[model samples]
Target: MLMLTLLGWLGGYLITTQLIFPPPPPPGDLFEVPDIRGGGLASARERLTGAGLVLGEIDSLLHPSVPEALIIGQSPLPGQVLRPESQVRVTVSLGPQLRSVPDVSGLAEDRAQIVLESSGFLVSVDTARADLPRGRVLEVFPRPDAILPLPARIRMVVSTGPALVAMPLVLGLDREEALILLDSVGLIVSEITEVFRFGRDQGVVVEQEPASDIELERGAKVRLKVGMSGRATEQ
Candidate 1:
């Protein structure tokens, strides 16, 4: 009788255990994994959920061509059959890789542009007059060594040479007066042509090449046509 009572207690204990913890339902059946590559995270989640599968851990990686938060790869791949409610792993793209901004200051503008572009960065040129050499880069935006995403625009300050000096209007002025005016502005007389213009005073400038108000470099040459009392000039 004691053994029989022990057997009954054992049976009751087994039943209680079964009721409290039953084995998980055999994987709800198999379903094909949908292609989630190139899809955004939200869309990928929806698709996976609809398939009775769960979106698994996401791994982010930098891809040059893929956009951010888009799936670049998937575990088990697309079209694979797996038990329902199985977790699907995916690799998400963090967009293009970020690059360190190179030191381009003091480099020439064209050279700087080339270097930045080669390093996968876009470039913008801002010009200013500096004591630095013409076309040299004076400063850079985001500064050197700053990390930025690919295709990011990097603005650089470039020299537009020393402060601009507009050419003075020396037309109709006498040769002596024109010479003095050009000299005062760091310019020099390159050539002088004598022309005969009726009613014009001798040694008076009749025409000047490059006209006036045009930007010219220091010590640049200015050609002048001087009025003379003779018509013995080439046309």
Candidate 2:
């Protein structure tokens, strides 16, 4: 009875190992190579993986025939038999390496953004001084005058034209200081005399024509008053 049991166990083992298992079908042999030229890196990777092969490091080369991202050439060309798990090295075209960035300083923001995006670059705004409606091209990196090679992005700063800032309070500031503040905000100033200080502060500014906290148009002239008491000179 023991001998019979041993024989039965050996028979079951052979069947399971040889006929049923059979080394997992030799891991699905891959003896055929597929053409992956012109197929971008992503597509090429998928095909290779499907064929039980692994993609190796891809190198970029200068190829005049291939346009930018298109695959220029591949190794182990289409017909070679590749073993399963075999690594294939490939060289892809890096397109035209940009020698410099394009000039887009004066160009509108929308147009500039489009151009940069097409070149595979992110449109970055280092500093935005103005927005739409103010209308103007402030500046851009790489400059509008300079010529740039292909495969590069054009970064730019769009102008909102001129800045419109509310005038600062200058009631308490002295004449020179008030004039300085007015000039800083691009305001024009005219000096006049107000006789209200009653013998205090003669040359000192008595009051502003437009007064404090009043929003005046840019470049508009505002009058300044100086000095006190009944007979103040309105010069």
Top-lDDT candidate index: 1
Instruction: Provide the lowest-lDDT 10-residue window in model 2.
Output: 127-136
TM per prediction: 0.46, 0.36
Q: After superposition, how far is residue 101 of candidate 2 from its true place, in Å?
A: 5.4
lDDT by residue (tens digit), candidate 2, 1-235: 9999999999999999999887754455656777888879899899998887778878888764576766677778888987788877788887664444555556767776776667555566654555333333467676655544554445566665455657677666666787888898888875566656756775677677776766655676788876653554656
Model 2, position 156, has a per-residue lDDT of 67
Compare the candidates by TM-score and give the number of the best one. 1
TM-score between candidate 1 and the true structure = 0.46
lDDT of 1 at 88: 95
Clash pairs, model 1 backbone: none
Q: Enumerate residue pairs that collide in model 2.
A: 68-95, 198-229
Off by over 4 Å in 1: 1-28, 32-60, 64-72, 75-81, 84-89, 94-96, 166-215, 219-235
RMSD of each: 14.2, 10.7
Model 1 whole-model lDDT (C-alpha atoms): 0.87
